[model samples]
Target: MRRRGLAFIIVALMLGMLLAALDQTIVSTALPTIVSDLGGLEELSWVVTGYLLASTVSTPLWGKLGDQFGRKYLFVTAIVIFLVGSALCGLSSSMGQLIAYRSLQGLGGGGLMVLAQAIVGDVVSARERGKYQGWFGGVFAVASVVGPLLGGLFVDHLSWHWVFYINLPLGAVALFVIVAGLPNDKSQTRHRIDFAGVVLLGGATSCLVLLTTWGGTTYPWSDPVILGLAGAAVVLLVAWAVAERRAREPVLPLELFRLRAFTMSSAVGFVVGFAMFGALTYLPLYLQAVHGVTPTLSGLHLLPMMAGMLTMSIISGQIISRTGKYRYLPITGTAFATVGLLMLSMLTEHSSLWTMSVDLLVLGMGLGMTMQVLVIIVQNAVDFKDLGVATSGVTFFRSIGGAFGVATLGSVFSSRLNDDLSRVLARTRLPPGFDPAQVQQDPTAIQRLPPELAADFLHVYADAIATVFKVAAPIMLVAFALTWLIPQQQLRETTKAADLGEGLGATSAERSSLAEVERGLVRLADADLRRGFYARLGSLAGLDGIAPQGVWIIARLDGKGWVEAAELACRADVSRATGRPYVDQLVERGLVERSDDEDRLRLTGEGRVAAGRLTRSSLESLRGLVADWGDSPQLKRLCERITPELLGARADRPR
Candidate 1:
């Protein structure tokens, strides 16, 4: 349709994306207050971990469901589920209840993020979709930067409950706009979803997360409960492997492991996720509890990290795009991450905010450099048929890594803090009737103590956080070691390194090989156009006489083959009277011809030659987008297939 209608649809989709993306980071700052209100400081990580685990497991299911069914109503259902979860979370009275609700919310959040991207393929054509996909990616970047700050604002100024409640109004607006503006899905393709694999994998992951979360903190290492979970984890993992091998469409194909690149990327991705999530979860506690900062200021303190991550991600992508060599990035990235985590481990209650900022910035930059490149490496490594699954698989490992990271590190923090608190509380005298358990459950309770006692408790909190990072640092070193196994692969011309948005907001939307290429090309084209792309392309095509609009007309006719002369002006978005002169000029230049009846227009022999030249020009310019990728037959064929569509009238426009 109309531009207005498309605009509304996009707005609604963006809002849905924003809600899902925001929830991922918004709760980080709020976690402190949430624990203060609900008790169970030991369970703090689960609030984020539950959401992550649920979302990661559900992503494949949602993607397959949307394909088997239609995305429109499924997306609507996802929004409803998300809203309901948000409502329940806001009303939760216990840590357990909040964690469960967050998981429920995560189920919908997965759908929202995946479906929103999938919906774009439905609403926009391949040639023009690149720019729209970029917009969606942009939504993720904005969410990453704003989610924490917004969460802090709600927790400090409003109630912590408002963090979840905020989704209500936004979800309602998105729901309304989507229903009104989105078209009905007419797709009938069916897919066999790997239900058994999903179930087994989910069970396996849950067992693993719980084992890590409770191993030292909730139960002794030798506790039967812990041992049983370990046994269950191994058994479930074996079962999942069997299910994946037998299933027609596995959640994560076992065959991917055979590819050295895929295996290495997944390993590195997992470690990055582990470190990134561990930091995101605990840094706020350090700020609010140890540094005595407000929730909002804690969020503000995170900006240096965000800036560093975003900056390095872009810089790394551009460098890869230009050089077409990326093996060194992961190696460099992991090194930075290991050092950063080590730096973070050194932080104490006496540390300055400036020192923390530098440490966080370094960590963010390292993660930013590493995370975005993994997907690109996987995409280039796998066969075309594995494109979608490979892309999602790498990110899937990252999410799982994050879950494990938070749980594992949280266990470290809880164990250390409890031990220290027990020993210190026994030696020091407290006011009559003050319960030591209160201090164990809430760091804020330390402020109720005498000044000297409170300072000691803050030191305990600070030391525990430091130990968490200390444990995390070596894990990143493992990722650094794993990166060496990733053999340097040639960057295919069609392989576009993910931009800041896609890198930050990793989505599970599966597209065909050509579709992926087209999306990347369109994004490259949009970026190029802003820098006088068409003029350069026209010069390359030897059409210096034609304006950019004229080049568009030539491409339009070439793509359509022929068009009714009477409809040309409207298709061109110009008036018939005003367009006649332009048509005559093309005819005079021998680039176009009128039919015998003069009611239709078609490219002349000379016009066809110009179109062919223009196609070559388009391909050349596209190659320029990835500067160093040498010429290839595959690149030429892809460029030819999409150039006309890229230059023609948008497929979604009103006829």
Candidate 2:
């Protein structure tokens, strides 16, 4: 039953993932048709690139917001945005408008991937997560296969708008399952937000993306437009890195990178992304343009690639489950990918379809072996306190690398195609007024081209794609080499039982430490009335009315005729101790008077005055306290009637 629920959860998250994954592929199949209708070939790539740029920019914002509030609301909100974007996309009539709308879709798509993967990691243990992660490759396979099929169906019989329309229903289902079935996740709680660091990072990342998209395609590398952006990106990125080091709560945890293995692995993941995007983005184009197949047939040709993905993913998962060693998977996976890409470098317009399929299978096998494994490696190499940021940081860099690879590789392909087209045009005669700009900007121009010229132009496109692959293969080879640095540490096989003593029920040493803190004080008055003080004053109480000077002593000692016996006897007429004798009798009867020696045994003025005046320290000092206590002053006054009894009736009366 637990497994069943877990499986249901996995399926739900995959559905969210499919919304983004399918968009990437389905749109690719339908883009040519949309462009032909919209007639803006010059701006064709932006429809894809703009979405990526917007999505990448918003990724961290979603992650931070989720950390601040709850993940569930944001998850639901992300789906809503995606659905809205999809609706807007279907409504767009112009290429530029479509690109703008797709960016809105990218914003939500970005959140879905980051939070969906992060939320899964929260619930599942890394050891058991292998099977679920393998399910990602499964979704990737399904999306990869279905995207083109659905897009083809929509384009052939229905309107191409259905490609975008399809996302609304799927995304709605994903939103429902996530919002209704899943528990409200608190894994993203935070105390302080690094708003400053976020701003710096967003600015820096924006500059970098702009540089990547514009460099080598717009103006020159040294042009102010390119140089200024590139330089600003570098400066801001460095500044952001430094700022994060001092932050109490950093947007990106810099500490994980201090560990050499994780640092290298994250770098390797970024490089791995370069290879992943380079291949994934262009393979369909290769299958179509080079193989002379329609976009729909080309998507079917990718089945071997999907099979390769499933085969490697499941196999790697089972092996990791059995042996627990995981570090070597990425290292080996990148190696196979490099070798596969090397095989595909042999691709040509006339290359055999079977050969291309086999080559792609190898590439897919390599991807399956490696992609999800890097996330596990990153999580392992960091402290548990840093789990979310560290995990997101790794994904962040990978996304960055994909954007980098796509923009640069795409630009290169376009530039090279233009070069090839110009040369092909030069070789053949054309009308004197034929302008390249007009031809390049208009999709309708492709249909009007002379037969040989059309083939020439397409040949240039085929070579341009091959050129990117040639460049990309070497990059993959480098990534394969870097994977060697990935430590062969095993996936931790079990969720370690939680250490229950994280808070409050602390150890004895801690209790002792706390005790020392609370048990302290501030300085107080020096008057602590000592023993025998009252007894010392009793003798003086008896020596009264000797003289005016003598009276001073009487006044002084008049007070303490009333306290503890030891204090009363402190100066007791050496006689008072002998005769419980009415020391009371002497003082009250005035038979014996108090001393007159100045200051000889004087009490404080207030005490003397209180004793002599009240003949009762009893009524005034305690009057208010006792009145409230006993209901009335007279009743309170009566309560003290027991003093003689308290002093002892027999002792007080006769002796």
TM-score, cand. 1: 0.91
Give the winner by lDDT: 1
lDDT of each: 0.84, 0.59
- In model 2, the number of clashes is 19
Candidates' RMSD to native: 3.8, 26.7
Worst 10 residues of 2 by lDDT: 520-529
The TM-score of candidate 2 is: 0.66
| Candidate 1: C-alpha lDDT | 0.84
Question: TM-scores of all models?
Answer: 0.91, 0.66
Would you list the clashing residue pairs of candidate 1? none
Model 1 / residue 275 / CA error / Å: 1.0
lDDT per residue as tens, model 2, 330-376 = 88888888888778777776678898889889987887787656655
